[model samples]
Target: MLDSETKATETPEDHADELRLWLRLLTCTTLIEGEVRGRLRERFDVTLPRFDLMAQLDKAPDGMTLSDVSKRMMVSNGNVTGLVERLVESGHLDRRTSETDRRVQVIRLTKLGRAEFRRMASEHETWIADLFADLTPKDVRELMRLLAKTKASAQKSAARRRP
Candidate 1:
């Protein structure tokens, strides 16, 4: 039988509320991402990176280039290339050589790919909502505002530290 055990960690009673909020945020992100990835794999046999790339493209008015995808994903060019290649091979995406710039290849979702992405995105939204179902709509709105504020501050701090 598996034992449901947990190790103890030092409590930050000196700053317990802030510590608890940070821990909760971390735990929620991990659990939500885990469940999101699991659903994608189960339903489409797709990895999260590929799904993320497709999702990003879906939001763009124009399709993305290989370099653009890499930059937006904050991943290495090689990594994006590998994932895009796999997606292309699976017939979920189409690659086109740009007429204005032959060197740039634009990647766009095929009709099938668009359909798949839309369906998955719908389900993903549902999953995230369900995960936070216990929270009221007002609570959710407040949480989003707070999280956005936190993210902005963090980014500002990072910018200041750049050498």
Candidate 2:
């Protein structure tokens, strides 16, 4: 049987260790994301993108403009606009033109939206805890530290590539 680090088609002999590590990281992320998506749908009847958008708004109590939400969520404005439209239609979000700029639309969670998000967030925290239950506190801390370094390295590489 192949070990977790080894694939039948690509062994350590055929690929660099770094390539294997990247694949391992991607697989882990995909698996965890799929699980979380299923749980959010089953428990809250909400899609992950919708939940994610709400999460962004939850952080900004005063609310966020569509462009700001798009940037923060790392998505296109069109995607954010669609999410906002659905959320507003469901009465979970309030939309209004900015007082300072009529062309800028800002959105905030309604009372019901905040309340529901809080409830979902509380349970989501527990779900995350359960998902990582196998990792010890020290392991979690070490992974976090290493991932921070990895992020910094990636950002530096990206900066070098950008014009």
Number of the predicted model whose lDDT against the real structure is largest: 2
Whole-model lDDT per candidate:
0.85, 0.93
Question: C-alpha displacement of 54 in model 2, angstroms?
Answer: 0.8
- Clashing pairs in model 2? none
TM of each candidate vs. truth: 0.78, 0.87
On residues 1-163, what C-alpha lDDT tens digit does candidate 1 reach at each position? Answer: 2233322233323677877998999998899889889998998787788889889888864788989988888899889878988889988888899989999989999888889999888988888778888999899899889999999988898999993
Candidate 2, run of 10 with poorest lDDT = 4-13
TM-score of 2: 0.87
Clashing pairs in 1: none
Per-residue lDDT for 125 in model 1? 87
Model 2: residue 87 alpha-carbon error in angstroms: 0.7
lDDT of 2 by residue, 55-129 (tens): 999999999999999999999989998999999999999999999998999999999999999999999999889
lDDT of 1 at 145: 99
